[model samples]
Target chain A: MKARVIVSFKDEVLDPQGLTIKNALHSLGYKFIKDVRQGKVFDIEIDGISVEDARKYLQEIADKVLANPVIEKFHWEIIEK
Target chain B: MKARVIVSFKDEVLDPQGLTIKNALHSLGYKFIKDVRQGKVFDIEIDGISVEDARKYLQEIADKVLANPVIEKFHWEIIEK
Candidate 1:
């Protein structure tokens, strides 16, 4: 199975990296951009696992390793099975 | 409009970060994981622009700023309008 996971800071958390990107865009004259949020994406392939087991394992991976519970959250979906 | 952009290393490029993550997962006992690739995601909101213009500007941003053409590629989609 192939999966994609996205991990991002919570809305309440300040994102300096996103602000930096927005500033860069403004400097480059992309002034129409109002906001930018930056995050991490993981493309994962799992072998020899049922779809149900893959989902559960991916969920556990996202929670335990991919995201920081204090300020980050994660979402994952199976892209292929 | 709101858009999502993903930038990732080209297949020919080596991704040490992804390898590190995969190793970490392996040590943590996610033995089913076959491969992993890491990438960046940007969530952007554009104001006062037509969807057509927004898409064009976003394409430029992805090409010129978010992705390194030498070793990375990018894909983007408008999420809201």
Candidate 2:
């Protein structure tokens, strides 16, 4: 199975990188752009794992490694091969 | 209409954030984790625009604002309401 993990900063966390991109977009004449929030995506291929196991494992990964719980949040979906 | 934009660093660019997460995962006992690359996803709601027009406008936004062409790549999909 494959999985796609998305990790992003929480709403109250300051996102300087996202802000920089937003400003760059405004300068590039995309006035329609309203907001920009930057996040991370992890595409992974996990072999021989059941969907339930995958979810549990991924959650652990997210909590312990992929995201900082205080400032970030992560969610993932198992992809069908 | 809604759009989902996925922006990522090109393979050649160094992703320190991704590396840090990968290392953290290793430390956290996720030995199964092999590689981790991070990217951004933009969920946008675009009002009053045709799909083609939206694509064109988003392309300009991505090129000029959302992504750094020198180091990043961006792709977006229009979502039907």
lDDT of 1 by residue, A1-81 (tens): 899999999999999999999999999888999999999999998999899999899999999998898999899999888
lDDT of 1 at A55: 85
Q: List candidate 2 stretches off by more than 4 Å.
A: B10-27, B43-51, B68-71, B79-81
**Number of the top-ranking candidate, with TM-score as the measure:** 1
- Can you write out model 1's per-residue Cα lDDT over B1-81, one digit (the tens) per residue? 899999999988999999999999999999899889999999999999999988888889999999998999999999989
Candidate 2 falls in which docking quality class? acceptable
**lDDT by residue for model 2 over B1-81, one digit each (tens)?**
667678889989888877777777768766566666788887555666567778899887777666789999888887655
